[model samples]
Structures are given as C-alpha cells and as structure tokens.
Target chain A: MTTYYLEYLKLKKKLRSWLGPIIVFILIMVAYPLTVEFLEKDLEKGFYSLLWISILLSMMFSTEDIFLEDFNDGTLEQIIISSSSFPFMIAKKIFIYWIMIGLPISALSFLFSLGITKDLNLSLFVIFLAMISSYIFLNLFVFGSALSLNKGSVLGALITMPIALPVLIVLGKSIIALQFGINYLELLLLLLGCLSIIISTVPFIVSYVIKAHLE
Target chain B: MWGLFFTPEDFVQGNSYRIIYLHVPASFLSQSLYAAMAIASVIYLVWRVKLAAYLIISIAPIGAIVTFIALFSGSVWGIPTWGTWWQWDARITSTLILFIMYLGLISLHASFSNYEKADKLLSWLVIVGFVNIPIIKKSVDWWSTLHQSASITLTDKPSIDPSMLYPLIGSIIGFFGLIICLVILSSYVQILKRESTKSWLKDYV
Candidate 1:
C-alpha cells in the first residue's frame, strides 16, 4: 500500500511538470470559447464549443506524455514487473492525470462561456457536463496514449477523438437539453452508463496494449 | 445488376431514392467488414496467426473506404430528403463516428510500419473498436425511441415497399460480393508483397 501511495506521489510529481502546460492550455480553452461568442449567438453552441475546446486541449496535455515519459526513462519496465499489479498502477495514473487536467477544465467551463451561456445556474450545469466529459475523455485519452504515447501529442489527440465521439454526441445533446430547461435526467444516466463502460473496459485494454508493446 | 437498372422510380423519392442502392449495400458491408476484422483480430490475438494479422492489416482500408461510401451516399440522400447537409440524426452521427474510427485505425496501422509488435497492437485496436458498433447501433435506437413520443416517426418506419425492398436486397448482395472479391484480390496482393522473398513464389509468379 505504501508503494501504491508512493507511486501516486511519483505520478503527482510527474504531473506537476505538466502544470505549466495545463494552465496555458486552460487559458487557451477559456479564451477560445469566448471568442466564439460573436460568431455563434446560440447559447447551446457556445456551451458546446467551450466544452469541446477544454476537452481537446486537456486531452492533448494529458495523453501526449501519459506513457512516453515512463517508457523513455525505462520506469515503465520496472512498473510492469513490480510486485504490484500493472492495471492498479495505470488506474492510479489515469486518476491523477484527470485531477491535474480535467479539474481545471470543468472549473473554468462556466467562466469561459460568460456572455454566451448567460445563466449562472446553467453554467453550473456546464461545470457538471464538463466533469463527466473530462472523465470519459481522460479514459479515452488514456486508451489513446497507449497506442501513440511514443508518438507526438498531435497523433495522441487524433487517435483519441473517434473513441471519444460517442460521449461527445451523447453529452452534447444532454447539455443542450439542459440549456433548454428540459429534464435531462435520462440523458445524464446514459452518460453515466458510457462512463461506466469505458471505466470497466478500457483499463484492461490499456494494460494489454502496454504489455504487448513493452514486451 | 438488375436492381440498379430495372428498379422503378418511387412516387415520393423518385430518382433520389436510388442512392439507396449504394447506401444499403455500403451499410451492409460496413457491418460485415467490421465483423470480419473483429474475428480476424481475435484469431490473431489468441492464436498468433500471421495470416489473420495480415488479413486485418489488408482489410482495414477497404473497410474504411466502404464505410465512407455509405456515409457519402447517406449524406447525399439526406440533403434532398432531410433538407440538411448534415443532421445529428442518430444513425448518421453514429456512422460518421464509425468512419472516424476506421480512419484512426488506418492512421495507427501506418505509424507502426512492420514493427514486430505491430500485429498485436493492431489486433487489439480492431477488437476494441468492434465493441462500439453494437453500442452505437443500440444507442441510436434508444435515443430515438425515448425522444420520439409517438411510435411512428418518419425515420422509424418498420417496413419498406417491395419495389424498394427487392433492389435493396439485391444491391446489398451485389455489394457484399464485390467486397469479398475485392478483399480476396487485395489479400493476394498483400501476400505477394509480404511473402515476396519466399522461394514458394517460384511456384506461382
């Protein structure tokens, strides 16, 4: 358990290096959404734009180096062969990466859409939407990282986008529905369903990919 | 072939509906090709069969192009009928995402470039991607059924008239045949390229 906690701390230290990029990326995410305020006057589009920008940017930051640093330093080999289970370590990595990346995006989701989304209550809803999206995206990006982690961030973002699309579609509608004052409880449950499926299925796949690649 | 020429124009869709000839068959190939890739990928992963891995490697682009045709024809049909270039209509969006997946697969395949680990990694992607197909199909149905309130939305109609039905079935069969032939031919070329150094090449080439 100390090893797990120690591993978590190492992940935190690795993640701290990402803080500079995360803040810069978050700034771009915030500014880009507001820039679209004039181009698209619809409140829903505004919220959607902000949501996707944060996701895309955060994914780039989170996934690009998710595995590359470890692989380069050869720590990945040690992690794989350790007495600790590999998936446990990967799950922990993903959890910390989400905290460093997703939290800020979700937090700033509303501030980014100040003039566009308009209502404070709905902006809070945007925060909720952003959180679920980032959770789903972090997993998708983690999966993508396993594939192209040695490649650049551009490919990392590219590979993750398609697997991430369903959530984007499902949540886009749910958030749009929320904006219209419609009850989106059903859609929220559907999003939760997607999150659970990704959570359950992707880690195993990631572990397999890493093992296959590393071996 | 008969379906393409002999089918009569419809009262509503007229000539525009004919794109269904391409659309339905392409859609059929989309699902079947993915099924093939998934099966081949599973065989390769479990048994470590090189041929199965090569089959997936060879088949990904063909499947991706076939998916593109379905999306294009569907989009063409939609423009006149749905009065929009793109509709977030569940089926269209879901298929577009599938097409994106195919593109991603192709991109991933290109990056590895015959590395020893390439086959295994690609196989995992194929198997993982197959999970999305049924989910996308069902999610579309569920979303539409929940929202439509009335059971009979224009898009949810259960039956097609015979004139449309027979040709669609014919076109689907025809397209399937074409894809099979194409895959076989491509597999032959793939084998030749991959196995060119083998002394067995003297037997045929």
Candidate 2:
C-alpha cells in the first residue's frame, strides 16, 4: 500500500507538470457547445455529438505524450528495471492518465451537456458512463501508445483508431440511448466486458514489447 | 472440409455469381490473416519474439489485398442483388475499416527507417486493432446492421446449400494457399532487404 501511494505520488507529480495546459484545453472543449448552442438553438443533438467528439479528440491528443517523453528521456528503460513490476508501473501511469485526461474531459462533457441540453440528470449519467468507458478506451490507447513509443505520434493515431472503432460505436450508441431515456444496460455491459479484456491483456503485452525493444 | 468441396452447384445469375467463390474466401482469409497477425503480435509482445514481428509485417500486405478483393467482389455482387453498387451495411463498413487498418500498418512500416521501432510499434498496433475484427464479425448479430447473417457455423450446418458449397470451399482453400505463397515470398524479400549489407545489395544491383 505504501509503495502504491509512492507510485501514485510520483505519477501525480509528473502529471501536475502538464495539468495547466490540459485544463485550459478542457475549458475550451466545454465552451464549444455553448458557442454551437448560441449559433443554433435547435442544434442540440449536434452539440451533444460535438461534445463527445471533442472529448474523444482531446483525449487522443493528450495521450500522445504517454510514452514519447519516457522514450526520449530514457525513463522508460529505468521503469522496466525498477523493483516494481512493469504492469504495476503501467497501471499507475494509466491511472494518472485517467485522472489527468479522462476525468477532466468527462467533467467538461457534463458541463457541455448541461450547456447544450439543459438536462442535469441525463447529462450526469451520460458523463458517468462516458467517464467509465473512456477510462477503458484510454487504457487501450495508452497501451498502444506505449507500444508505438518509438514510432511517430501520427502513426500511433492511425494504428489505434480502427481498433478503437467498436468502443466509439458503443459509446455513441449509449449516449444516444441516454438522451432518449432508453435502457443502455446491455451497451454498458459490453463496454465493461471489453474493458476487462483489455485490462487483463494489455499489461502483459506492454511489458513484452518493452522487453523486446530493450533487447 | 475436403468432403464439403466435392459437390457442385449453379447460381441463378449464371457464371458471374461464381465470384462468390472468390469473395467469400478472400474475406475469410483476410480476417483469418488479421487474426493470425493479432496472435503473432501477442506472442511478440509477450515473449519479445522477433519472429512474430516478421510474421506480422509479412501478413499485412496480403491481408490488404484480400480485403480489397472481398470489397470489390462484394460491390459487384451488390450491383446484382441489391440493385446498387454499395450499401452502408455492417459487413461492408467493417470490411472497409479492416482494409484501412491494414493500410495503416503498411504505411507505418514504410514511414519508418528504424526497423526495430517500426516492428515494435506495428506489433502493438496489430494487437490493439485486433479487438475490432471480432466486433466487426459479430456486428451483424449485435446491431441491426444490414449485413447478411453468418453462413458457416460448427454447431449448425452451413446455410449455403451443398451445390454452392463445393466451389466456395475450393476457392477458399485455393485463396488461402495463394495468400500463404504470397506472404512467404514477400517475407523473403523483407529478410533480404533487412539483413543484406550494402555491398551485397550492390552486387545484386
């Protein structure tokens, strides 16, 4: 537990360095819906879609830094050699990623929803599911980003997007369902299932790739 | 499988419908190749196996070609059956995305001079992208997509009649064989390119 806290602190410190600009970006994303709403009041659905789109794109942008810095600074090498297991280290990094990127973006999503749709209840639920699902999505993204650390960022984006299409589709559908007040339990279940699978599989894959690259 | 390949059949649309033989197998082989690449990627990542990277890269182009054939033939088949060139059906969209993913892999490889970096990156991409293939395959079932239902299953006999089955199975096997040959040939080229010294390459040049 002490070790976990230490790891968390280390990640939090690293993340704090990037938090300011990221927060400003989240604010901009949140304000997008207000602008769209002002431009066309009836464009509510479009505003909602745009909100999710911005969140997705913002997350993608923030994730580019996931491994690029580590790879450049040789920190990744040290992490691999640390007494802490590779998976634990990666999990901690992903946890930091979630806190820094996913949580703020989700909050922005909720704020955008309220601005556009003016329904606090549905907006909150939508944000809840979006946050949960995006955590899983970012897990997969960071895993891929870690894999592609030596590759350029654009290449990482290309490789990760298609793999992420299903998640996107499900998230979109669930959001739509939420808007319409329909039951989205099945979609949530599917997202959770996918999240579980990636969580189980990704650490091993990341460690393996890192080891392979080091050699 | 061989027994299923021995029967004969005719399509109501005549010989053109025979394209089904190519289309079905090409689609199947493409998906299987991606699946194999995914597994190879997993092995590479899990074991740090260099061989798996070679296998993944070798398979990408062949998978791209197979996906192309599947989409082209599906488009042709659509013109006859659905009276249009294309539909935003689940199967078509998924296959298109699959093709795009393959191209993405190919482009990533080409974009990098650092082979080691490219291999590691592509391997990771392959594993991550693999999650989509299953979803694509099952999309027709999971969503109200306008794609045809899956024809082959183990628990149930194929929905395709025995008449159509023989040629379909034969074409599938033949396509698989052809893809294997193509991949092996390409892999040899990659190996030579990667391992040969400048003098060795110059000798050939």
For model 2, how many clashes?
0
In the order shown, the candidates' Cα RMSDs to the true structure are 4.0, 4.7
Per-model lDDT: 0.74, 0.74
lDDT of 2 by residue, A1-215 (tens): 67567645755676543464356556766566456546546657566556555655666666676766677788778978878688777776777677766787777678767766788887887777668766776776666566556765556666677776667777778878876779988888888888878777777777766675666
What TM-scores do the predictions have?
0.85, 0.81
The candidates' DockQ values read 0.53, 0.52
**Candidate 2 CAPRI assessment class:** medium
User: In angstroms, how far off is A153's CA in candidate 2?
Assistant: 1.3
The alpha-carbon deviation from the true structure for residue A191 of candidate 2, after best TM-score superposition, in angstroms, is 2.2
Worst lDDT window (10 residues) for model 1 chain A? A37-46
DockQ of model 1, rounded to 2 decimals: 0.53
What C-alpha lDDT, on a 0 to 100 scale, does residue A10 get in candidate 1? 66
